[model samples]
Target: MKIRMRTIGLIGYLTLLMLPIYWMLNMSLRENNDIMSRLAFYPHHPTINNYVQIFTDPSWYMGYVNSFAYVGINTVISLLVALPAAYAFSRYRFLGDKHLFFWLLTNRMAPAAVFLLPIFQLYSELGLIDTYLAVALAHTLFNVPLAVWILEGFMSGVPREIDETAFIDGYSLPRFFLTVFLPLIRAGVGVTAFFIFMFSWVELLFARTLTITEAKPIAAVMTRTVSASGLDWGLLAAAGILTIVPGALVIYFVRNYIAKGFALGRV
Candidate 1:
């Protein structure tokens, strides 16, 4: 009886969690007219036209490409910059070190809107507007501080003896970091990269503000679904589903590391 009750509760919770996604999928498979005309749990006359249109339309599909390009760039830049900064924080003591670390976290604490105008002005002056580098750099203002904080926590957990032993064995700084130190905090790196990617990918304000047509992200493109006739409900639903896939895949791949990060890092 207890097992049966638990199973029922689990099913109920899952159903609630998945209801919106199922509804969106149902809408994606039906015509907009059918969607407006009736309320249905499932599509009676299902079609794949919405998905097909997105794939075939350059404007629709390039949004995904442009998003991935900048998101990739942001993640790489955040990690590269964060790793060394984190190492210094973890391994050394400097004048104003505590204040500096707190200051980095302060950047993450501030609202993105606070920096938007200044970032736009800087990028415009630099001719980085409407480019992948522009969006990527804009996102770093937040992601880098976060990456540094997380990586620092993970690095702090490592024994200082490891660094001493590596140096004693004549391992160069770069060689030791890549071959030994980084592997020791792989979970933190996975978690940091996942966060950086998701933040950059879903961030619309900076991406939209910085780009025109060439570097528009999918989130920004989704807003253009409205037309003279009305909203393209079916196409919008399809794009929404596709937009979710990349984040879902990232979570799936790094799921185990995320669990470890929660346990091991200062997440």
Candidate 2:
């Protein structure tokens, strides 16, 4: 009886978790007329027209390109900057190091709204507004700290003896990190990169304010669909569904790494 009750509860939880996603999928598949007529458990006449429109239109697809371009760049830059910083924090003791680490994290804690004006002005001064670089650099401000935190945990799991042995073998610092240390932390790298990509991809405020045309991200473009006439519910639902793909792909690739990443530094 207990086992049967547990199974039922598990099924119920899964159903609850999946209901919203199923609803969105249903909405995306439904025709506009069917959707407006009344709320139904499922669509009477399903169509792929919304997805078709998005793929065939330049404005819709361009936003995806811009989003992927910046988020990809941001992930790479954040990892490059954070890997060494995390290693330093995990392996060595330095002046005001704890204070400095916390200070770096504080940047993540600060609201994006608070920094929006300054970031906009800074990008304007550099003549980088409405460009891919602007959004990528802005995302770095938050992503770097998170990468450092995640990578530091994994780095802490690595023994200092590995560094000593590498030094004795005449491996230089860069060679040691690239050839030896990096492989040991592959799981951490995957996890950190996944998070940075997910956050940067979905973030809209900075992307919206900093980019106008050339580099506007998908999240920002989704907002433009709502007009004074009425919400473009079908298109909006289609865009919302599409927005999950990148994040879902990232998680799929890193799913194996997540458990190991959490276990890192515990020993």
Candidate 3:
């Protein structure tokens, strides 16, 4: 009886969570006219035209390419910068270390709008506007601090004796960090990369502001679906569904690491 109740509860919870995604999928399969005309659980006249449009149209597909390009760049940049900083935070003690660590979190805490004007001006002067690098660099301001926080937690969990032992074996600092330290915190790295990717991928304000056609993200392109007539409901829904795919794949790959992170209290 207890097991049955738990099973039923789990099913109900999952249904609640997936309801919106299922609704979007349903909407994506119907024409915009069909969608706005009725409220239905399933599409009576199903179509794949929306997905077809997204694939066939350069403007639609390029938005995805640009988004992925910047997101990838941001994730790599954040991880590269954060790993060393996290190691320092985990292994070393310096004057005002706690204050400095807190300061990094404060950067993460600040709204994206706070940095928007300054970043836009700086990039404008550098002629980086409308480039993938612009949005990627802008996202780093937030992602790097978060990456450091997550990585530091995992790094601190590692024993100091590992560093001492590696040194005794004549391992150089960079070699030890790469060959030894990183593997020990692989789960953390996965978790951090997943977060950085998600944050950059979903962030619209900076990406939308920084890029025009050359580096426009899918989120920005979604805005184009709205026209004088009305919203292209089916296309909008399909784009949303496609937009979810990358994050879903990332989650699937890093699921084990995420589970471990939760177990280790580092998520």
Candidate 4:
């Protein structure tokens, strides 16, 4: 009886969690006319036109490409910068090390909105406006701190003896970190990369504020749904559904490592 109750509760919880996604999928298959004309749990007449338009339209598909480019850049930059910083924090004892670490995390705590103006002005001055690099760099400001926080925790768990043994064996610092130390914390890296990628992918404020057109992200482009005829509900829903796919795939591939990452890291 207890097991039955638990099972039923789990099912209910999952249904609640997945309700929005299922609704979005249902909406994506429908026309704006069909959607606004009635309220139905399922699409009475399913259509693929919404998805088709997204693929065929340059404005729509280009948004996706631009988004992917920035996300990839931010993820790589955040991880690359964080790994060394995390290692330094985990391995060394220095003046105000804890204070410095705390300061880094504080950057992550600040809302992205606060940085919007400064970033905009700085990028404008640098002539990086409407570029993939601008958005990627802006995202890195948030992602790097988080990557450091999580990576530091994982790096700390690694025994210092490994470093000593590697050095004793004449392994170079880069070689040891690449071949020996990194493998041990592979789960943490995977989790960090996923997090940075997702944050950059979904973040609209920075992405939208920084780029006008050439580097506009998909989330920002979703706003274009507002037209003289009102919102294109079907098209918007399909884009939303497609937007979710990459994040879903990232989670799926890293599902095995995510648990270990959470358990092992500061996350």
- Candidate maximizing lDDT: 3
> For model 1, how big is the CA root-mean-square deviation?
1.8
Candidate 2: residue 169 lDDT (0-100): 98
Candidate that beats the other on TM-score, 3 or 4, i.e. the better one: 4
Candidate 2 lDDT by residue in tens digits, 1-267: 999999999999999998998888889887777788899898778888989988899888899999999998898899999999999999999999999999988988989999999999999999999988899999988889888988898888888999999999999999999999999888778888888888898788999999998898887787876653377677778888999887777778888776765553343
- Sorting all predicted structures by lDDT, with the top scorer first, yields 3, 1, 4, 2
Number of colliding residue pairs in each model: 0, 0, 0, 0
Write one digit per residue (lDDT tens) for candidate 1, span 74-116.
9999999999999999999999999998898898888889988
Q: Assess candidate 4 and give its TM-score to the true structure.
A: 0.95
Candidate 3 global CA lDDT score: 0.91
Indicate the residue-level lDDT of 80 in model 3: 94
Q: Where is model 3 poorest over a 10-residue stretch in terms of lDDT? A: 258-267
Q: Point out where model 4 deviates above 4 Å.
A: 227-229, 260-264
Q: Can you give the TM-score per candidate against the true fold?
A: 0.93, 0.94, 0.94, 0.95
As a whole number from 0 to 100, the lDDT of residue 257 in candidate 3 is 76
- Cα miss at 18, model 4 (Å)? 1.2
Candidate 4 residue lDDT tens string, 164-240:
99999999999999999999988788888888887788889989998898999988888865554479899999999
> Which segments of model 3 are wrong by more than 4 Å?
227-229, 259-267
